[model samples]
Target: MADNKTVRFGLLGCIRFASKFVRTVTQSSNSVIVAISDPSLETAKTFAAANDLSPENVAVYGSYEELLNDANVDAVYLTMPVTQRGKWAVMTAEMKKHVLIEKPPALDATELDKIVEACERNGVQFMDGTIWLHHQRTVKIKETLFDSGLLGDVRHMYTTMTTPVPEQVLERLTKEAMGLAGAIGELGWYPIGAALWAMSYQMPISVRAMPSSVSTNSVGTILSCSASLQFGSTTTAIVHCSFLSQLSTDLAISGSKGSVQMNDYVIPYKEDTAWFEYTSGAKFVDMHTGWNVMPERVTFDCGGTEESQEAMMLREFTRLVEGIKRGDLEADHRWPEISRKTQLVVDALKKSVDIGCEVVHL
Candidate 1:
């Protein structure tokens, strides 16, 4: 890592999802993937070839340890399974390399804490792969709905992120090797993060999973579930996540003066522009045929012309890593804090589900 130089990255897994990062990192201006590793050397080589990665530029390794040992590898992007990532992330940090992990960062918050602690102790940066948060649309939403007080005192939030998964895909998702074999761990992270973001990253007082809403596979891997989070006496967030629903990503936030609504909060339908609906001070007309005000459609152009949300995330993480390398800045604690808060809520909700949908105090 050097000032005004590209931050080299080692991708630690050759899974299908890792391909996305391969493209994003290449599209990013500040980062580049220099190495790739998987359990099988042949698989790593094949993945690199499929991605059209030049051998002279990208090293292929059969073991993660070998890639981590490469001095040119400034950081690591963990695309491994949820259960296997924590130790590897800790190892990455221990070797004084920054780590970017895919979400849900771990099976539970306790596990996430260990990874974060390692980064803190080793003076490395740690960020979970929550791409939507890095989108320009998210920045606009924060300004209009939160900072501008357009939504007033927020009282309620509803979010759902789901997609129909085929049987083969569902089997892969629910495999015991994946650790958390459920829609909650796979798709729920978005809504959970969205709810926390709407509440300014505040922790909920309690979480209760709706028992009736929980559906599981033959292996007892959760396929779909819903949960309620009590933020305060007056504020609550309802989240529903599923692998058995029609494709949808919805978020709605209501406050004292207004409400914010969007159908695609996790990933916008279009890459160039994303929009939301906002409404306030509504009343029925004298004839009671319609409301006094209609919801306003607010749209924002995706700010990064060549950068998607995932690209922006890689750029931002690399920027931080560069700053640390330059000694002009310390690791930004905010990213890890956000990750920890989201993990805590997730753990609480999972606990609630395990305890017969009983409310779990945070």
Candidate 2:
């Protein structure tokens, strides 16, 4: 399966987010953009042209089903809204194509179950568009957390992501939330993922959303939210995500002896490099004065200077897809397993919100 071949990719929607992926697939060594399907023919065609997809290999369709039947596509990227993605993922798998979907892969456990079961039954690899998971910078951090003596016990982690949403957007989301912040599944996905990643994808024992911490509309649409997650008795996590605040996303991890901090964890400030600070073994000086430890800044240069986080994801996806195509491997479950863990926590967070911030038993 590790032969030299390009993994043909089909874009399911021309969502603005898909443009980054278009570039990544075209630039990747083992991937190529071969088809696009969306409701609007012009939207799909324009996107294809802007990306400079070859006309001979790249086809455009006004309907997703037509693209799925093209026979040229080996994999499809689903970029629909979270509530609608589950049905499409199942359809993609049933059509015998590998599926890469946007984050929060499904709205809840029931939908996630359908996606996982379909992918497994159809023998198609499944992954979410959580680009950070595939970033080289995140790779370095994982090493420091697991292998390095820094941040010894992983006792606590805090992750926050917030970006102010316009009135129009808020109006749409308010209607969508129904009663509570139905949009929690969307904006909260990143912080939830960061928390889960910091905890090594272990499901927390329970979750308690911050009571009275959400900003809602008259009908109770969640504009902002915060939650507390408990893992056993020692490990805990805090997550805050909102659509009513200024753009600020951060992560900090602390243990018994030391800590780590980053200003941008969901998406790096730089495309080619990521920055963070870590400290270990802090103690007062012999004179019982200032602390003895000093924080050291570190940066990791991802190999591809032009490769965005999305590019890294496509490169990884294509490599595995290439192997599967060459019969070198079956569907790799590693990515889907991680995705499932993230979704499990996401569902729990929603439950917490649903029950008025009560502790949701996992």
Candidate 3:
């Protein structure tokens, strides 16, 4: 039986994203959001009230240190800005608190290594909060496409995830906020994860990317990219990602015998059904609803499962903490490998964009 002890969680930074996560933890059976800290007291109180957490149970700290010092917090969820995530992760690790940090855990590999070492030394579990990896859809896609051998030997993979930049997000795209590596950092990781997962983490043989100079910011608005990845004996893949225009969140893979396609790759909710196509000749045949194979399609009508990304992330974090307390290290080992490989591909893509040629040995 799973241990029934509640993992007391304190959320750092009452940012807009934390609200949904607070609600998820409140509803989770294995964990609770016992404390919250933000620079603004009013914001913290408002979040607590909206989430139905008692104001007394919610400690509004003026600074993160105040929250870190609290004895009641067994672990922490770090959802601050990408630039500050490494610092917070290191701090939390030094304090001996398990941490689930937001994506791009660090701006560079050096910072990621430091954060990893800190967590190791402190004897705490550390994970990058890449929510999609935790979702069941990823596993199902892998099994059906790779394990089932339904598609024969995989050859090509393409994914598109695009949406208009929110006004708030546009405002923060300045170099001062996210540096010159804009869209690649903010949006490229999703496709990177998908491609890597599909290839079963086989390092790509070569990668190339080109950013269209359409936006005013140094971070290009439109990115046209192609990666040549080799997996096993005869499997080769061409993968693409862009932040340029509106295309359905689509992922299509072609093999020697047949091809499989999935629409709505990034956010596949219960209400949203993904379209699948298999190529026979010049025509494509639509497969039955892909929901049965995609476990994330399993929905809850009540307080548990919802459409909030933040909620899904928090629930997964709670599961990780529970595993940690029980000395289960399997999940912990996989995180660093996946994170490092994802960053490596991102780096290769940037190099390809800069040199106007394919980057090899990524």
Whichever of 1 and 2 has more TM-score, that candidate is 1
Q: Report, for every candidate in turn, its global Cα lDDT versus the true structure.
A: 0.86, 0.80, 0.66
Off by over 4 Å in 2: 1-4, 174-183, 218-220, 286-289, 303-307
Which wins on lDDT, candidate 1 or candidate 3? 1
Order the candidates by TM-score, highest first: 1, 2, 3
Measured by TM-score, the strongest candidate is: 1
How many angstroms is residue 256 displaced in model 2 relative to the true structure, after the best TM-score fit? 1.8
Q: What is the lDDT of residue 308 in candidate 1?
A: 69
- Pairs of colliding residues, candidate 1: none
Model 2 over residues 1-362: C-alpha lDDT tens digits?
12349788898898777888887776676777788988898888888777787678788899899998988888999997675788899999999899999877887767888998898898888998888878776877789755575678789888888888897777677544332435466667787888788777888899888987777766666778899889889998998888888887888989876888988887888787787888888788999978787888887776554456777788778778778778898888888888877778777887788788889988
**Per-model RMSD to reference:** 1.8, 2.4, 5.3
Mark the 10 consecutive residues where model 1 has the least summed lDDT.
Answer: 172-181
- Candidate 3: worst-modelled 10 consecutive residues by lDDT: 291-300
TM-score for each candidate, following the candidate numbering = 0.95, 0.93, 0.80
Query: Per-residue lDDT for 1-362 in model 3, tens only?
Result: 12346788888877777776676676566777778887787877776777777866666676789899997787898887777878888999899888877777777566778888888788777778777665555555567656777667667777655656655556556655654445566566777777777777877766655334323333543233445555555665555554445654667777775666667666664422322445422233257433223212222232336534445566666676667677774336567778878777766666666665544555
Among residues 3 or more apart in sequence or in different chains, the pairs in candidate 3 whose N, CA or C atoms overlap within 3 Å are: none
Per-residue alpha-carbon lDDT of model 1 for 150-210, expressed as tens digits? 7898899999988998877776665555555367877888899999999988888999999
